[model samples]
Target: MLIVILPDDSRREFDDGVSAYDVAAGISGGLARAAIAAEVDGELRDLHAPLVVAEANGTSGKTAGTSPAARSAGAREVNVRVITKKDPEALGIMRHSAAHVMAQAVMRLHQGVGLAFGPTTATGFYYDFQLDKPLSEEDFPAIEAEMAKIVAADERFERMIVPRAKAVEMCRELGQKLKVEHIETGLAGEETLSFYRQGEFLDLCRGKHIPSTGHIGKAFKLLSVAGAYWKGDASRDQLQRLYATAYFDKKELTDYLTQLEEAKRRDHRVLGKQLELFTISQTVGSGLILWLPKGAVIRQTLEDYLKVELRRRGYDAVYTPNIGKIELYQISGHFPYYSDSQFPPIDLSEREGQKPGEGERYLLKPMNCPHHIMIYKSKPRSYRDLPVRLAEFGTVYRFEQSGELNGMTRVRGFCQDDAHIFCTEEQVADEFRGCLEMTQTVLKSLGMNNYRVRLGFRDPNGDKYVGKPEVWDRAEASLKAVCESMNLPDMSVEAGEAAFYGPKADFVVTDCIGREWQLGTVQLDYNLPSKERFGLEYTGADNAPHQPVMIHRAPLGSMERFVGVLIEHFAGAFPLWLAPEQARVLTVSEKSEEYGREVEQKLKEAGFRVTGDYRGSKLGAKIREAQLGLIPYMLVVGEKDAAEGTVTVRDRLEGDIGAMPLAEAMAKLQAEVAAKTVRQVADGGAPPPPIDRGPKNEY
Candidate 1:
């Protein structure tokens, strides 16, 4: 007998070689029915796998010499759970089943459709198919209906392990060219391959599927179809990609669909057009954004505010050219590492008889770090200047795929609020802490309080990184120490995600609607070959030369992406301090026009972004216009208030706050502006005074 510990600190005794399914069955029929998968110790595995005594240090956590009943009573508690013996399967299994069902449905409805690959993604799953004709919305209903039929058949889903040669033969016989290709590449010397079958459909997969097809809940939807290259290589053959989603329960699936709809409504591209903020012209190249006047004002305000904060924190601003000789990047090691993403090199032969390398073969800047490094190496340094920080609002260009191009978030050309610090090993921790503090401050000021930290480290086996093992270890240790010392609320470590040059830490912010965006990043690099190639050195008290550590930090990742996120985060209602037009003065009629202008001039002189509406429109009409514009405050001037040297203030989401003296109103507005107030007042509304109408449609 063997003993198995259940989740609630209970233990059960069973015969030797008893599987997790058998344990679930011993507990209750309902539990066995509800079990989808089993977590054996810390690893996820098939529920049918036998549960043995786990060794002290084995990854599987299994051992022997214990009866089921005795082991159940003596088994230690662990974070493990069992799935249904023969009922619902795991989420991955469900998604994979759904993909098979969808593919089967596609085959039934369309002729000459060959399957490529279908795999579960982070959210759901997608299947690629090579078809003779392109798919459209018209075919979705037929495919869905066929899928429903397949689900209702309740066919048994059996898993079989076959030799790799036999699997290849089966695929070749079925004309599954893509499967053959995958098997040839993914399988090395392994003789066996896993395959799953449900009814007439058989797929090449490594799976732990549900007992039957009917176990798939009625919470599946075929979302859309698009074109994708085979194996994600653009040069390869094109395939039709069908996107879909599935969930264990119907309500959760419905909620996800609703959220997707809401996301479409809040898309920055749509809002940018509706709000007249920016434009992307076909005449101009893709990934290039043309900022309208209002958008330009907002960008300028964000830049100025950040610059002020940077200066206050001891950062010296600097400038770099938009283009530099190709040799600069070659020396910095960016050319070879980032070649695919960079634009083609520019030949300077037009100027004279200059070959590619003879004269400056100027290329557009891809990042500001290389130039900043040059600035650091321009002069010798000592311990006093150990933590020298240089900042720049540099614009960079990259060749982004056309399909990946969206609004400002994924533009080809964008400006980064970039900075680089040259510091010794001893100052790395303090410098990283300072960067974290600055990131927190920036997020708070922007009203982005919900965020988490992600520590990105290098993969030891990957050849992409440039530094030695010891250097990489020290860089990673510095980041980890800073995160721990700061006592961050929530943090996660991810390996094999570092930049080609070094390890990095990212500040990920989730907006109001639960969409996460990487807002800031700080990287530690000790392996830029340029430091050695250029003979960069710092002197110590021992009169010996040593290399300086490089730290690259960007608080606001890029101006374009930051503004795009800010737009959606606040839902277009910017805070008082950041609003392009903070206040607008509305006159009740021609009688108060002079007072309205006077109020606007006074607010403007006091450092407020104020505008006046003096086109002889009604007070209500002017107020409505301002409200639609998302202005934070609207000051009304009328006969009673103007005569008494007072103004009626109307808050944007809060109605009127009665009348106040002109000077007092100015002071209150100034204070709110300085404080960067984002919250509106309570919901006691006020009625706008009546006014005589003038010209129609006049502002």
Candidate 2:
């Protein structure tokens, strides 16, 4: 007999050889039919895998919950939870299986294709194959058609476990050199390996798969294909990566495809060019963002908003150099640790023709905290000045691979709204709580209320983290306590997600499209102030030197990335306060040109970003131009309105409102701008086509 614990903490006894499927069947027929996988003792397993109970006394036996003595003996209790198709975890399992099916289809279509690795990403699954002939978008239909046939066959996925040596022999027999090499290089320590076979197609995998191919349904689609290096090593053989997505329901797939199209339409790169916000030129660098005049305005507005809040919260703004001595980072433990992602050090010796010891080396600062740390150490403090807050919109650089560059979102050079606080241990909780509140306020101010808080703690098993175990524990506990004391959104504790020096709280915001982006972070560090490092200290009431704890935070983590996400979040239609060009004056004809110019001048005098469209163009053509530019308001001064000394206001989305006096129009726009109100544009409403009125209107 085997004792099983259900999800609800209920206990059940079953035969020793019974499987998870049998347990599901015993519970309900519907559950058994819907069961795709099972999570056993926190590890996902095949639904049909036999249930085994291992005792705590280093013994294996067929036993049930016989007596309290059995529990007292420390026998391991088995926990089994059946995963259905509807469970969120089931999507990844299905996607993984879908990759196998896709691979099988590819192999059947194209002979002798060497398979590398097929893994599931956040959005979909991709399989890398080393093929003589490169796969193109044109071949997607054929590959997908083959996948449909395999799905229709509903072949059961059978698993087999074998010795590692035997697995290598099987790979060799199948002419899968990549698999053989992987088994030798990656899995050399494993004594046994598992393989899954469906029909005549066999592959090596560690799987938690659905019972059969039919479970994949007809909701799978093969997306684009791209070239990838083997194991992401550029020097290795290039492989074709075929991307695809799978869903249990057809409607979900349809919705996902629709979202994809909408995402393309809202792409920051495309909108950035059309709206003339920012640009990336290969001549300057791939990941360096060049802020155009309008983009600079948006960035400046964001900085000013954050600066006001920082000042109200007792933060002192400071400036730091773009480049710092390499030794500075070495002392902070940022160098040699993040060296792979950082630009090469600048050699003063090479330029001065001096020996290595005679000259200094400099690095493009990868982080702002070290600079802030130096500033903290620049002054002596008493316990009365326990918490010192320093803030900066510091620009930093990292040498990200060319492939990873994605406009402003993933740039080599970017500015961070970074701040650091040095406080006593007793004040850590309140300081961290303040940072959390400030971060929440920033996100809320921008209409990003739908977000999750993730507490990133150090992984005990990982060697990447610095500081003592006890120090990390205290830091993590302080963060957790602060979170508990406050009412916040859904929060999760994630291990191995913390920075090298400390534990951090990350705010991940979900956009309107249901996609999540990590936008803000607050980290507590005990290592930076330790004696072995920066040696930051303060004098206590007892006249004794004491170390101060440091808190590093960035509510809007990277201004570039924040703005990039904002562009997509609002679809390039900013609110009145944030709009680069708040309003444009459009004249119906030359008869109203003077009135349009006067309206523009009046708005400009009122401290609004306003422009005049005095070109002799049709009123409709001018409106279309303003709408396309996503200007928040268009003040049309037609012949009648010009004579009446009133302007007809057209909201970007709501269109025209009746003529209002100039004073009234200014007040209305001013109110909206002052309140920083967010207005939604109607769905499926495309901007009117642009008419070539003349050269002046050309973007």
- Point to the candidate with the largest lDDT: 2
Q: What value of lDDT does candidate 1 attain over all alpha carbons?
A: 0.78
Tell me each candidate's TM-score: 0.83, 0.91
Candidate 2 accuracy as lDDT: 0.87
Error of 2 at 336 (Å): 3.2
Give a tens-digit lDDT track for model 1, residues 1-699.
Answer: 455666786766566666677777887888777765677665655556566544457433354433465456654333347765343337667777788889888888888778887876646777889999888888888888888888899877776779889999999987888889878986666678888788888888776666666777678988889888876688988899998878777876777677666567667787788778889998999999899877888889878888988899889999999988888888777786788888988877767777645655777999898898888888888877778899999999998876567798889999999998888878888888888899888888877787888898999888887768888898899889889888885788888878877889888887766667888999888887234544567887678888888888998998898988877766677888888788999888898888889888988888889899988877889989999888999999998887899999998878898789989988888887677666732221121111111111100
Candidate 2 residue spans exceeding 4 A from truth = 15-18, 26-28, 53-68, 71-76, 347-361, 639-643, 682-699
What is each predicted model's overall lDDT from 0 to 1?
A: 0.78, 0.87
Looking at candidate 1, what is the lDDT of residue 193? 88
For residue 436, model 1's alpha carbon misses the true position, in angstroms, by 0.3
Candidate 1 backbone clash number: 19
Alpha-carbon RMSD of each model: 9.0, 6.7
